[model samples]
Target: MHFVTGGAFHGKAKWVMKTYSASRNMEGWFNLYEAECPETDQFETSLVVLEGMEQLVKKVVQENKKGTREVLQKKLQSWLEWESDVRGRRLVLIGTDIGKGIVPMEEENRRWRDVSGWFFQDTAMAAERVNIVWYGLEQTIK
Candidate 1:
């Protein structure tokens, strides 16, 4: 599995798709969040809807606060199912803009940044490879 992430509008999904398309391997999965709307596409893609960064963070926080190995395993299982059923590939790309810096507002914005950071970290742990995009450049983080 591969996890590609970076700040908002940093082009992480773009780079991952380009790389995936260029790969000689015919079998692979691509899942993108926020970058595209969640509707069935002919091509393999899983789009997760979070509404906004705040909602996304809240989900992460709630998950973490309720931490359990079983819960983590279940999350991983769900991801794998998407890869298999939706994308049909052992190699998978889960893309998101989880590295965006904190937004200075109230508890909501701060919580978003913190929760997103943790989400990225968890994704990286689950992925065999992790890439961070900056200025259209790809840097391996794992």
Candidate 2:
């Protein structure tokens, strides 16, 4: 698994697309911004690019208030297992760096930030490669 993160509009998606030469017409490119994550059986491409994970994390945190981390972890583990199930198959996750800057006053917003941070941390730990993009530049962190 590869994890890529950066501030909104920092070119994370552009970097990923260029790095992987990915396109929407590709068989297995799943950008969460456009559609939902596909099930393992439905995954039909060698590479899967998953964007907008922070929003998914926010949804999970909001819907499963008591088990947000557990649920996200489970989903991560499932994706990792699927990636490992076949040689050459890869999972590329792109998330916005929403945890930085000023903290939100709303309780729900704060919770979203906190959970998204933890979720991103978990993904970075599990990922074989981690990167941060700034101003359209890529820097490998893991």
Candidate 3:
């Protein structure tokens, strides 16, 4: 598992496409904003890219009416099932750094940001490699 993250519009997608030579194969891109998230079995490729993951997690938090710790953990565990669908040896997860900047005034919005940050931290811990792309430069953190 590889975690690639940076600020908004930091050319993360471009870097992944270029670095992985994705144009050579049919790369699967999972967009979080879609009405229905793509099923893992729907994709077959050498590279599986989960884009807008922050949004996906935010949506999950929003949908969980209880917002309890147990509920959150169960939701996250279900989401992690995608890890099984990583094509070949690559599963590049791209998330926006939501921890930067000021805290939100709305409690719900703030919780979304906090949960997203925690997810990123945990992903970095488990990832075999973590890369931060800033201004088109790559920095390997782990």
Candidate 4:
């Protein structure tokens, strides 16, 4: 798995497409918001791109009935496990860096930021290679 992340509009998507030699095909690219993550199945091909994971984390944090960090953590744990267990799936995950910049004034926003930071760390640790794009430049972390 390759984890790519950076600030919004920082060229993460462009870097990912170029790095993976991906074309503009619906079969290879996926928007996580359009699909139900909990019910998503294993990929059959060599590469699969799952974009907008930051939004998914926020959505799960907002939608979880318990509205607790533990619930969000558990859900993310299951989702990441599912991704790791898939056979022959080379996943390119694109997420935004939400923990930086100003601290949120709202409690929920702060919680989301905190949870997203933790989730990203866990995902990065699982990834075989991780990269952060800054001003369209790529820097490898692993």
Separate clash counts for every candidate: 0, 0, 0, 0
Ranking by lDDT: 2, 4, 3, 1
Error of 2 at 66 (Å): 1.0
TM-score of 3: 0.80
Whole-model Cα lDDT of every candidate shown, in order: 0.52, 0.89, 0.73, 0.77
* Residues 71-113, model 4: lDDT tens digits: 6456555556656676665777889898999999997798788
Quote each prediction's TM-score: 0.57, 0.94, 0.80, 0.81
Instruction: Specify the poorest-scoring 10-residue window by lDDT in model 4.
Output: 36-45
The candidate that wins on TM-score is 2
Q: lDDT of candidate 2 vs native?
A: 0.89
lDDT value for candidate 1? 0.52
* Candidates in descending TM-score order: 2, 4, 3, 1
Query: Better model by TM-score, 2 or 3?
Result: 2
lDDT of 1 by residue, 1-142 (tens): 5666665667765675586553323322322333332322333434332123333345555556544334434555566565567553544444456445547587645655665666656767877777778888889979
Superposed by TM-score, candidate 4 places the C-alpha of residue 49 at a distance from the truth, in angstroms, of 0.8
lDDT (Cα, 0-100) at 81 in candidate 3: 63
Better of 1 and 2 by lDDT: 2
Predicted candidate 3 versus true structure: per-residue lDDT over 1-142, tens digit per residue: 7888999989887888888777423557776656345555664665677778788777777887555345545534544565654535467788889888999999888888888887787778767788999898888899
Put down candidate 2 lDDT per residue, 49-73, tens digits, no spaces: 8889998887887787688999999
Error of 1 at 41 (Å): 14
Off by over 4 Å in 1: 22-55, 58-73, 81-103
